[model samples]
Target: MTHHNDGVTTMPPTAAAAQAHRRTLLKAGLFGAASMAAGLRAPAVRAQAKRFAGVTINGAAFQHSFHAALKSWLPELEDKTGLKVNFELQSFPIYNQRMDLELSTHGSAYDFCNIGTPYAGRWITSGWMTQLDEFAHNANLTAADWEPGDFARGPLAILSDANGHIFGFPWVAGAIVMGIARSDLLEKAKLPIPATLDELVQTCLRTNAPGKTYAFVNDQLHHWEWPPYLMNEGGTIFRQPPTDLMPMLNTPQAIKAAEIYTQLLSSKCAPPGVLSYTDDQSQRMQLAGRANIRTASIDWLVPLAKLKDSKVRSTVRYAPLPKGPGGSFPGVNANGFGIPVGAKNKEAAWTFIQWALSKASFERMALQKAYVTVPRRSIIATPQFKEAMTINGQDVGQLYIDTVDAPGVSDYMKYRNMAVFPQVGEKINIAISQIISGQANAKTALDQAESAAIADIRKAGVKL
Candidate 1:
């Protein structure tokens, strides 16, 4: 096997080389507990069994709990399938770019890949990925075994192209646009934590002060946070679904949301260099007492609590997104694994995916030191997981549970020019930056963004 990255490719482990590596891993004690926890009984040594050649999978390489769990199970997979699998981790920002480039060139670089739900539609439609419905059915992986609500019809529908063919399995599924705050800070401030957008704005104004902690800071990049704010206000960047050709980016509600965000920035309610901050920066700022409130993924809370800094450890809390005029509108995003089209070893790739997603493995992974929320319904309801959350002082695990169960707004490729939402997000980011920098008013900035996005979407050949 060979692994390639950044124009460099290197030979991966051979069958004999991998067998030796597996023995070393066993000696170092990486697989014993996971195997036992999953009730995976070791087989008697076979006399020179057929060796399935190795495969490489590409996915986001961040230090997320899901990746850690997958790492824990890799050794066991090697033992069972006789397939040496290599994982190439990329940052989320570059993950899609790399995957698209590989697919476009028809490079046999990855047998499987982890794709976000938003991009899955494009991949399926473009024929970059295989239809997994039959494969999943053959493997006896029923939707019933997984969290029905997490992969409910509404959300799962977004994971398909116009033809309604499923392209990926729900891996680490959850709504990402929500708030995590220092509950202890709100208690100290003698203020009730806001549950509505109006209240949230007031709280920010009241709690913000230079040289003192500000109340709220959000990631200003082209990502999940601002989209929910628009959704909550009953507004959307585009008038139709999936394609970006006919954008309503300058809707009144959108301008209102942008104005509020601009006020927060101008009032210094956010940290210095806030515009340069991404999701991690916002989370770190809140965890370090630089800000009291932040909008981020619910999955982030568990890791944030485990931070070495005592301030964040003792103070953090999680909550659903504040209600907007449209009610408690929140944006949903999903990440999961998919088989790439033309994979050389499709069966072996599916075997690894099935093993990683089995109920047994899900339970073991969720209970790891870092509390990763698995998408399996059975795993979330387990008493052990509940107790773990309680012990870690994170009682809001149920909030995540309930949030995932609820209906949410999903991004599909069909609405604006196919797969243009990310580009729309960039326009929104630029507009917000202009508003905050005082180079343009909220209405003016959003108007320009709306016009530019519409033009771009039209040029992409998507009909409104």
Candidate 2:
């Protein structure tokens, strides 16, 4: 409404002038009312679009595909939320060692970090990571569609405490599955994909050559690779993980698995430097057609068929890690982002995490980067995504889901969830190296490992 002023002069004031002043007062009153109404409808932070304008989130994590995909959208995150991010990516080992020191000292150098499954238990129990329940459930901070329930339960359980306090939002959840780089070798040998332990050994022997193309390859992290074999042989790491907490490394089952895994490496089925091959090296070996089979997460194996640089792209095939009489237990793990308890900018870091692990972001990373190990059921269940992950007539997406749904994954993974597992796991690796080098047989090596693990666990203050 507009007010018109009459051009008439009077002794005191004209009616038009009085009316104009009343109109101005009415407008002011209405404006205040509208402002209040808007405030009631929207969060204050939303009202101020640049609320965190000067905030900077210093994040630190290991170099991973999910982080690599996320960095591509850093500028977009800043523009959307007025938060600047200085994210540092390091190798897995370097990040773990440095983060351990930072957490132990309560340093606040990083606002957010990659909380891997193996370290999450120790970090969470130590109170190094911020409890994310407050931030995740905050209506004003978290969006309605953020859907904390969308995360796969198995992987999400890894990041949650007994009281159901979630510490991280997952980005990479992977299950160990077999990738055959030489279908031609299987075809020539006239054998189907190996489905049992005995068959795996036989298949490996049939396809293995003394030199040139190797029959099998595994990463240097034998603690991770060997556990499934142990479980398959009815062996276990603990008497009962998270309960008894006893070291069972010297059990008969463990010795059998150790013998089998060491045989794979020591019998010349794997490369000369199989004991030293990192995860990247193992993947490259299969991609270059130098390794006949590789058992790892879809994150690494899928690249053999999808990455343009792969020499085995046309010959690669996918299968679950071969099952055995004791039952198959493929390794499953997730890496997620969480705010450090010492972080000065916890809220801003949480904002970045929610955005990075948002459903939309998962889709974009999967579709755009061809990343296959996302732990969201909604995306993984979609027909388009299923189609996107299919390779060479193999439903690798379904294989991933099956691997996650495997019963042993949840029951057996509790062993790895113990805070002292890393130390004990290192002992397992050392013992395996001893067996491979002929310093000890399987039983002797594992007996030494159990002794060392008991000492380490007790030193870590675990009752057993």
The best candidate by lDDT is 2
Model 1 misplaced regions, further than 4 Å: 1-65, 139-158, 162-164, 177-180, 243-245, 391-394, 408-418
In model 2, what are the clashing residue pairs, if there are any? Answer: none
Model 2 vs truth, CA RMSD: 7.6
Query: Residue 429: error of model 1 in Å?
Result: 1.2
Identify the candidate with maximal TM-score.
2
| Pairs of residues clashing in candidate 1 | 241-415, 242-414, 242-415, 242-416, 243-414, 243-415, 243-416, 243-417, 244-416, 244-417
Q: lDDT tens digits, residues 175-247, model 2?
A: 8888999888899989999987778888888889757679999888888888888888888888876778898
Candidate 1 per-residue C-alpha lDDT over 315-423 given as tens digits, one digit per residue, 9 for 90 to 100: 6666678878866655555666778886776766776666666777767776654455565656677788777666246565566666555644334324421477766
Please give the lDDT score for candidate 2: 0.84
lDDT of 1 at 425: 72
